[model samples]
Target: MRLSHLADYAVVLMTAAARYPAGARLSATELAADTGVPLPTTQKLMGQLAGCGLLTSARGAAGGFALALPAADISLADIVEAVEGPIALTLCSDSNNHECILDAHCRVKPHMGVVGNAVRGALGAVSLTELAR
Candidate 1:
C-alpha cells in the first residue's frame, strides 16, 4: 500500500533533519526551505514528531527542534508511525479497530497481523541515517 501524503512528508522532513549534524537544532521554516515542504505542513509535522518523542523541541529566542534519537536509532517505521499512528495495511489488522463491516466473516482477518508486521519490519529495516545519505 502507498503511504499517505502526511507520512511521506514526515519521511522527507525527517531525512532533512537527519542531514544536519547530530543535536543541531533546526527550525521548521529552515526544514521547509530545505526539503521544499510547505511551511505550515512542516510546522505541523514538527509538532507531531516532537509530540511523539521522535524530535525534541525547545522554546525561546533560540528555540528549535532536534532529533530525540540518533538517525541510526530511528527507523522509517518510527517516522511513519509518528505521523500515521500505526502501520496497519488493513482495518482488520488493527485489533482495536472494529469499524470494518467485513470483520464479521472475513477469512483474511487473522493473517492481517502477519502482513502488517512484515510491512512494519521492512520499514523498520530502513533507518533515517540511510535515508538521509
Candidate 2:
C-alpha cells in the first residue's frame, strides 16, 4: 500500500521531532523548515498529530510541539494509524468492510487475515525510534 504525502510528511515531522534534545519543543514552522516541508502543510499535520495524541502542543512564547511519549514507545504502525487509520490492502480486508460485496462468500477472508497479521507484524517490528535512527 502506498503512503500518501501527508503520511510521509507525518513520518518526517515525527522523526525530526525525535531528533530534538528530549523535551525540546519546536514550532510547526521550525519543523517544516528543518524537514524542508511546506510551512502550511506542517502546521496542518501538527494539529492533526496533536489531536491524535501523537504530539503535545504548548501555547505562548515557548509554545511548540513535542512527542507525547518517548520515541521508543511509539511504533510506526501507531503513527500510520494515527495519521491514516488502519492498514488495509484491499476493501475486502478492511475492518469496516462497507464496500465489499463478497463479505459472506469471499474465499480470501481467512487468507487475508493471515496477510493482514503479517503486515501488521512487520510494521510493528519497526518503532519510531528505529525510523528516527
Candidate 3:
C-alpha cells in the first residue's frame, strides 16, 4: 500500500508545476532544481506525465513543459494512477483477481474495499492546487 518513489516524485514534480503561473512552461532541469529531485529522474517522469496527458511538452529553444489542464482539474489519484497504475490494498482486492486462494470467501476483501474507498476519497478530495498550498 506504500507509494513508490516515482509516484512521490511525480506528485512533487506536478506540485512544482502547480506553483508556477498558470500556462507557464518549465524545463525538467528547472523543475528538478525547484523540487530538489534529480535531473535525469525529473526528465523521465516529465516524459511519462506528458504521455499521460497531465503535461504538455514544447520542442526547441525556449520550450519546456506545462500543465495540460488546470491544476484544479487534476487530483492526487489521477497522478498516482498515471504513474503507478491501479490502487489496491491487497491481491484479493485487485480487479484482475489473478489467483488469490481466498477469493472464494475472503471476509477481509469487503473491509478492504471500505479502506480502499476511503483512501480513494481522500486522494480524490485533494486537487493539485490544494497540494501546492
Number of the top lDDT candidate: 1
TM-score of each: 0.95, 0.91, 0.90
Candidates 1 and 3 compared: the better one by TM-score is 1
Model 3 TM: 0.90
Q: Indicate whether candidate 2 or candidate 3 has the larger lDDT.
A: 3
Residue 41, candidate 3: Cα error in Å is: 0.8
How well does model 1 score by local distance difference test?
0.94
- Writing each residue's lDDT as its tens digit, candidate 3 over 1-133 gives 6889999999999999999999998999999999999999999999999999999999989689999999999999989988987677776666675687776887777788678778888898999999999
**Which portions of model 2 show Cα errors greater than 4 Å?**
none
Per-residue error for 46 in candidate 2, Å, reads 0.9
Q: What C-alpha RMSD separates each model from the true structure?
A: 1.2, 1.5, 1.5
Q: Write the per-residue lDDT of candidate 2 for residues 1-133, one digit (tens) a residue.
A: 7789998899999999998878889999899999999999999999999999989999999889999999998888777777888877776676674766677787887687678778878887888888888
Order of candidates by lDDT, top first? 1, 3, 2
Ranking by TM-score: 1, 2, 3
Can you write out model 1's per-residue Cα lDDT over 27-69, one digit (the tens) per residue? Answer: 9999999999999999999999999999999998888999999
